[model samples]
Target: MKQTQLCTLVKKSEPIKGVFDFTVEAPAIAAEAEAGQFLHILCGRGVFLRRPISICDVQDKLVRFVFEVKGEGTRELSEFSVGDKIDIIGPLGHGFYVDNEKYKHPAVIGGGIGIFPLLKLSQKLYEPLVVLGFRSADRVMMEEEFRAVSAKTLVATDDGSYGYDGYAIELLGKELMESECDVIYCCGPTPLLKAVQSLAAEKNIDCQLSLEQRMGCGIGACLVCTCKTTHEGMDENMRVCKNGPVFDAREVIL
Candidate 1:
């Protein structure tokens, strides 16, 4: 179940040039939040619709979310100061399923801001391999956090400004060929997700992907955040906010 509450902003940080990380006091949401879940945050007064931000981390009575200042909604959210009360509804959406025993050696991969949710996932998956990608060195964020939880970590930047001078998928593909991982968990831009999906399929590895989509209502009613699914012999649309932000890579039409 989800709850609406006025969460108090307890801490904030700018991990990168434009991205903001917020830790809020929301015990109810924190208690139930799972990796890959998100929060529907009411971004101040003028922004009527809530912005859906992925749950980045959860501690005793606090939940954290990170966002880049993309528009008015997120821009307003960034200006909020400590002790400000913000209305939020969460631990929303279906999350990544963590079955360590089933997927013995899993590789967790993400690109850009998509890496946020995977942080929580890495904490859950014991010593999973992690791969992260960024457009350049300035855009890179959270290298140490991922390294703390992962057995091995690889980073790639498109511009050759930092880490490997190539796409992160290239590193993932190389690793897949060299070693054996039972499954893969990934989230990122559409193109990256597609590449990862194709690679996973080629290798016959089970994979799961978390999708990002524009949303109106954070719940299922609005139908704004729909993605095609190939389940139950039907090629129908599924709600990203409700059915998932997470799904088996094979079940989605992306």
Candidate 2:
């Protein structure tokens, strides 16, 4: 069940250059939200389409989401101040599977804004290793937050501006070569996700991927957010909002 609520904005901050973090007072959504789930937010009047933002954290009666201002809708959301009421419908979408006890030493990897959903998953895992990638130092966000929840955290940048001087997947590949992990969990751009998926397969490691897609309705009724799936011996298109924003690496066509 989904509820539409006018949530009070509690805190808004730009942790990095263009990204905005919003914490809102929405006990129902927070209480029910799972890691990798997202909220459909009404930015403001005249913005016909609600923006889908992934849940970054859930604490007590508050839910936090981090997003980069990519257009007028997000720019309007960024302008909202504390005490403002933001209309939201959530916690929507199928989330990451965190209870598979088969995965012991899991590696959580994310890129750019994709790191947002992994935060809550990190909090639930038992000291999983975290790896994050950014285009440069100025684009990096959530290092300390991931560090707080992870046993170890690694950061990589495309340029040599911060941390390792390459893609985070390089670091992840090196880690896999050095040691063994039960599984790999990831969310990122299509290129990054593809690379991670390939690497995981090369190493014979179990992996799960969270996909990002343009969505019309946050629920499956719209049928806009679909991905190719082959999980149940059926090769078909699955709704990301209903079937998953997360899918097994082996089952998804990527």
Q: How does candidate 2 fare on TM-score?
A: 0.97
Angstrom error of the Cα, residue 138, model 1: value is 1.1
Which lDDT values do the candidates have, in the order given?
0.93, 0.92
What stretches of model 2 exceed 4 Å from their correct place?
A: none
Mind giving the per-residue lDDT tens digits that candidate 1 earns over 12-32? 999887799999999999889
- Please give each candidate's TM-score: 0.98, 0.97
Off by over 4 Å in 1: none
lDDT, candidate 1, at 81: 97
- For candidate 2, the per-residue lDDT at 94 reads 88
